[model samples]
Target chain A: MKILIVGGGKVIYFLCRTFVSKGYIVTVINRDHDECVRLSRRLKVTVVHGDGSDPQILEEAGAFTANAILAITPNDEDNLVICQLADLQFHIPRTLALVNDPDNEEVFRQLGIKTALSTTYILSSLIEQRASFDEITNLIPVGEGKVNVMELLLNENSPVVGQTLRDIAMPENSLVAVILRDDETIVPRGATVLQSADRLIVMTLPENYSQVLKKLTGESE
Target chain B: MSSDLRYFVIIVGCGRLGSYIANKLSHSGHSVVVIDSRESAFNALSSEYSGFRLEGDATEFDVLKQAKTDQADVLIATTHEDNVNVMVAQVAKKLFHVPRVMARVFDLKREKVYHHLGIETVSPTLIAGDVFLESITTSPIAKREGIGL
Candidate 1:
């Protein structure tokens, strides 16, 4: 994908790296000359030194031809304007914006902008995870609750240890998506056996949350 | 305009500044709508804002339609990404014909270009710098803008 990113901060830097690693054509626009120099020298991406919110600058950076535009600047207004330009003017197929304030998400939505509110999402995830540790570490709803993404931690005394996924009676709506052991991640299969100290990422229904948690952690209480 | 009349405002990208604007606008009797792709971002909003909430990608045309962007009088894009904000604003102005479009700009060099394109830009870093400079000055000329510390 041809991607245009407007920002030179850590977020843009990391995103550029990820996109490049995935073999996407990435171009970054920023006002900071030093940052632009650093990215150009270090990363396999294009760097443009200009204001990303400006039409002239964006044009200079080839915003009109980009397949996807990511507005990850520090200011919410800039991100919104960029999305507008990409969608309304250039008719870019995909435009993603980073929302700094979770409250204003509705405003962006109403204006036909796709936003990712990181602060609000991260804080909510942390709070929810802390509040419902025993049930599930992370319960992220996907596709309007048709599927849920959950993170489950396994303990040494869990009853499901040493048993394969097929041996355990998994919830009807639940399926293990990924497993984190030490630092590596593994895709769980029916033949995959449960082990102690494993962190499982599962997809299930809201109603099956408790059941899935119980089956994975071996703690009914 | 009657003080009792409610104004509808759409703010894209619910980040720090976006949330601040939403709180201020809603408190001032404006009906606010927020849209973000990240479902978890809605927690920052207080229950006082009873406006519609949609969790989806802002870049997708369907998501914008779901947010009712066509009916909004003013659209504010405060996302960190400049490209996204510009794209959203451009669409609102050219296609949807939103009366007012305000964008937050982090890059100072693009300010002139944004103005030329008929989009309002706000930079926190420049504003903060002006505020800092105004505080140290003895003449108090900077106080005229009310940007003092």
Candidate 2:
């Protein structure tokens, strides 16, 4: 895969070495001239020295033919703009952005950037994951995870105990498939009200798992 | 705030443009609150300015909420970096639902994305470039007729 990376930081440096060793075509762009010289020498890859957010700079970096653009700049807006330009202007297939502030991730996604990840959010979610463990359990992955089915056990503390399936704001591309209550399996309908001790069989797109988990358990992450 | 009352303006970044706007608006009797990551940037504000000064990264939700961006009638993001300005402006406009949000974008090329995203952007580069272009185009007319900047 051809990869274009934007940033002068350690993350970009490490990724450059890793991707190159794996035999992927790698290119980098950094605003710092000194860092560009160092990266060009260390990685034996093309390094363009300019503001990554600028579309002209992206064009100069050969963004058009890149399979993916990973914008890991420390500045969230620059990362967002680079990804956006790569996606919208160049029609690059995949775009990833490093979010400095986690709150901007949703907005970035809403603005049509494919993947936005943040070290701040990941590390914080790691902590949150430990605190909110067992809220959702993976049952099994069917068909190489195009469909993910999970079992969500509802307790009295669950946010959906009294609410019907229709009333609950489930994440997009997710639904309650079945409700295992005692000896009977109840196929969930919109009017089906959640009861405590109900084992919900949910089928969701894999990416929406975390949101579904958090909402089902009433755990604020 | 009530529409009949003076506007509550929140200006992020106390850099040259931010300080100027803060000073002008505060003098005009609007409630002005300026935020910058560096406290020293606040020094640029004129002594006549009597607005609130906060030192924090305005792009952060908590920092902006602390500055009461939700209550802002007008939120102007004038950070030196276009990236900062765009992020802060979006947070103010989209997240906090501020009535009017403006961003100072240094790169003129970024105006399209800003416009598409529905955030009002003032590009200093375009403003200055227009003046330079106008001078080049109109200098001959001005020299003959006598009045042009």
Candidate 3:
């Protein structure tokens, strides 16, 4: 895909590199002349040194021909305008804008921008997950509710202590993904019995979350 | 706009930032409702607030109706997913015509794009920077304008 990224910051740099590595045609537009010169040299992609929101600059950067335009500039207004120009004016098939303010996400979506990334929302989600669990150490969403992989620390009160995988009444759609104990990870089988300090990595559906929590920690929900 | 002497606010996402905003608004005596796709997110909230909680995708029309977005004075989206947040906010503002809409943003640079699209955004990074600056400096009136705090 021919992707036009409207930014020259570190985010754009990484994005451009990723697209280039994937063998996609990448072009970046930025106001900083030096950054453009450096990026154009570092990555074998087209770089335009001009204001991204300006129609003339966008035209020069071939905004109309690109498969998608990503407005990732640090300034929200610029990203919005660039997306508007790409989506509304140029009729680009895909337009994505980075939303710096979680609050303005609605405005961009209302304007018909298909994709928006808010860092605050991402960081806060991570922080909230960390705050919610005591024994469940790391909870990462593998794919929606189909698979949620979580790292669990087994304290003395855990019900799985001294119980082999075969004896425990594990819920449906739940499986032991991995086990980390004493700074080492092991793939568990039916013969594997959990120790008191064993850190188990488990995957389960969203519906069986509380049950899994209860089973692993022996805590009443 | 009603003379019923009650202000209604609807917050979409029900995540940490969303819950924080809802709690703050509710504490200030405003009628607030919070909605999220996941029910687990709303478990920590107190039940004393006169607001409803609905579990569904915020971008869906049916979900918004269930949450009574039409009657809200303001709709805020703080969902970590930017696409969902923006979609919910737009639906609330343009479709439901909520009087006010606010979105939380993580990337400090997306401010220009959001502004151009006619959305109000609150950036925690910028707010924290301003607060940090304010602590060492004397600017009482400047502090008052930092988003009703």
Candidate 4:
């Protein structure tokens, strides 16, 4: 997939490296002339040096053919303009913006920028997750925060450890997608039995997430 | 115009142009609220300007909400930064559904973007360029040559 990233520091560099290693076509638009030169020399991605919010710069960065565009500028206004331009002018399918102020996330969403990720929100959520829920190895909001993907670790003391998938009373609208035990990935079925040390990848709606977690890991709300 | 017909306006950025517009609007009996990040910017407003002065960044939605932008009949974004003005204008127009939205953009290329987004723009650069071009084309060179033609 072709991806375009605008205006970031070390985070952008690491992201570009990772995407390049994965063989995805990556393009970066940066305002810093020296950084652009360094990125071009160090990575396989194309780097364009100019104001990312500018339509001319976006066009030069191949935004028209990009499948996804990430506006990671420090300025929230710049990020908003970049995402809006990508969506309205280039018709990019996915437009993501980095909202510096947590409150602007909703405003960005209202303006039709598909995804607005607030760095502060994400960092605070991570801290909350670590402090509150340990069994939840991973949690991610998908489909515009309508659905959640959770990873729960099952241990010997878990209530559903030895139960079969069909026998366990899973919450409504929740599905155990996969189980990873001893490095074996299993697509869960009705006959599949849960075992100790099994890592479950579950998907559920936001309303049913806590119930699903309680059922899988015996964690109470 | 009657008092009932007066518009409730929100002006972002207390720069020279913004202050001037706010002063004029307030003088005409329009309810105006001017927002600026710096408190000292309000000093630019004249004594005739009897509008509310909000000291906060206009890009933040909370500040806009505090200024009651949702109830504004007209919103003007006159920040020095074009992107800030564009963002504020878009939010005011698209999110709040303000009846009249305008911004001051300096770049000629960004004017097209403002047009596409259905926001009105006043560009000093473009206006000055047009005036200069007109002055050169309409110059009276024969008078300087003593021809009096």
Candidate 5:
């Protein structure tokens, strides 16, 4: 498998090593000339120094032939552009992006990215998994960071959509404080019905965060 | 245009071109809102301009919502970075359902991608090329004058 990665950092360094060790051809595109030089010198992977969002640059990096394109730029917009060009123009089979802002993960998905990794979202989920045994691992810090506030979208395909709040099994430590729908904020109640495309402002305790997120957005799992 | 025909225009970015567009739109009696990440960029707006100024990243959903992009009749993205403009235009058009969305793309090739995505784009590179060609092809005496047209 051929993998093309845009942006270089600790993530790309490890990813390059792992993928190369697995015998997959890896190509990296980084804007920093010096970083590109160092990456090419240290790693067996190919490195191209230019704006990865540019079609000419991507073409030079062999974006068209890649099995997967991972856009790991720090800026959400940059990452989105890289993924879009890879998916739409080059028709890369899979497009993955690393979203620095958790808020952009869904937006990137909606824009047709095959995969999005949000550390904030991942850490919470990881903590939720470990704490599942304890029934609320967030009590002792689920992962590394503490996330109390989050905004989640209810996709049209969500099973929980249209279900009354009272009927849903919400995690014990979380509260759905605000529901944003069509420019209006609704203070939800037990009798309130969840709707598709609704943005929920959830306040969750670290321990029970995973369960709350899972119940609210089961489609992602 | 009639006085009652004022448009609710949302503009992201306050760079050279962004400020120019915002200034012209505001003076033309449109309800304009300009957003920029840096507060200092807002200082570029002319004194006669009377538009709402928002200090935040325009590509962010929360910032767009705060600017009331959903209610905008039109959105013009003039960020210095073409990728940022394209991202903002896509969000305003697809997510918020803005009736008309346009972006200023520096690279002419990138403009084609945005056009395929159904975004209206203006490429300054192409425009500047024509401007230079026109200026250079004109007679020597015309060079003494301020502009060609």
Candidate 6:
């Protein structure tokens, strides 16, 4: 896969390195001459030194042949323009923009930019969720946040601790995908018995996450 | 002039061009709001200009919403930066559905992109380039034969 990344900074270096190591062709467009020199020296990728938002610069960086475009400029407006140019002019299949303002995520989507991710929104939501739920050891958002994969650590206080999998009424669209007990990694089934201190890997639709949590911990949020 | 004929205009970026247009529109009895990132930029407006001066970054969505861009009859983005002008003009046209959206883009090449996106653009660079080319190529017509000859 060929990827075109616009803008520079530490993030560009790391992204370029990771993508290059994965065997994907990567091209970077940055405005700073020094940053471009540094990136070219350290990474095996094409580096174009110019304003990434400019159409000429994007063309010079081979945006036409790129399969995906990532606009990660510090300025949200520049990022939006770069992504829009890639989507509208180059017809790139995938365009992702880093939205600096959490509020602009919806605006970007409304403006037709695909996959506008706000680091601030994700970080704050993760902190809030972690602070509120102690049993949920890990929560990963999948399918653009419509679904979530969560690891729930069960204890004696859990309501389903003594119930068999058949007896526990998991919420609609939710299931226990896996259960880890001491040294055993078991794929859960209807006949499997739930036990305290078991780590359950649960997959649930986002709407049913709270219900699933309540069923396991017996505590309503 | 009837009040119904008046326009509600939103001008982003209080630079020379933006302030000039804001002053003219305000003088013509149209309701206008000028937005600028720097508070001092509003000083460019003349005392005769009777309109609102908002100090904020126009690229930020909240600032445009605060300016009530949805109700604007016309939105003009005259920011010095070409990218800023294009971004702001697009937001007004696409998001707010402003009736008329115009932007000043310095890059002559970018004017085509802006027109393709359905936004009107004025390129000072292209205009000046044409004028300069014409000045050198077109010989001054001797309407009254050389007087000093």
Could you list the chain B TM-scores for each candidate?
A: 0.84, 0.87, 0.78, 0.89, 0.86, 0.87
Residue-level error in angstroms, candidate 2, position A67: 2.2
lDDT of 3 by residue, A1-221 (tens): 88889886787888888999999998889888899889988988999888777667777888778899989877565676678778766778999888777655655666667776666655665566556567777776543224667888999878789999989989888988888889878998898889988888888886787688888888855
**What lDDT does each candidate get?**
0.76, 0.83, 0.77, 0.89, 0.84, 0.88
Chain A, candidate 5, TM-score of: 0.60
RMSD, every candidate, angstroms: 13.4, 10.3, 16.6, 3.1, 13.5, 3.8
How many clashing pairs in candidate 4?
A: 0
Question: In model 5 chain A, which range of ten residues has the least summed lDDT?
Answer: A135-144
Off by over 4 Å in 6: A141-146, A177-187, A192-208, B1-4, B139-149
Task: Flag clash pairs in model 4.
Answer: none
Q: Write the per-residue lDDT of candidate 5 for residues A59-91, one digit (tens) a residue.
A: 999987899998988888999989888888899
Q: Say which candidate scores most in DockQ.
A: 4
Predicted structure with the largest TM-score when compared to the true one: 4
List the candidates ranked by TM-score, beginning with the highest.
4, 6, 5, 2, 1, 3
Per-prediction DockQ scores? 0.11, 0.28, 0.05, 0.69, 0.39, 0.57
Comparison by lDDT, 1 against 6, better one: 6
Instruction: Answer with 1 or 2, whichever has the higher TM-score.
Output: 2
**Model 4, CA-based lDDT:** 0.89
> What local lDDT score does residue A95 receive in model 5, on the 0 to 100 scale?
91
Model 4 alpha-carbon drift over 4 Å, by segment: B1-4, B139-149
TM-score of each: 0.54, 0.69, 0.47, 0.91, 0.73, 0.88
True contacts kept of 4: 0.80
lDDT of 6 by residue, A49-151 (tens): 9988778988988988999999999888888888888888888999999988887887888878879988887777666666777888887776656788889
Of all native A–B interface contacts, model 1 reproduces a fraction of: 0.20
> How well is each residue in B49-146 modelled by candidate 3, as lDDT tens digits?
55677888775566778888888888888887554555566567787899989887765454554666677877777899988898768655544556
Q: lDDT by residue for model 1 over A90-208, one digit each (tens)?
A: 77889888867664455576667765555665567556544746635666765523567878778877888899988999879778889898988889788988888888888888677
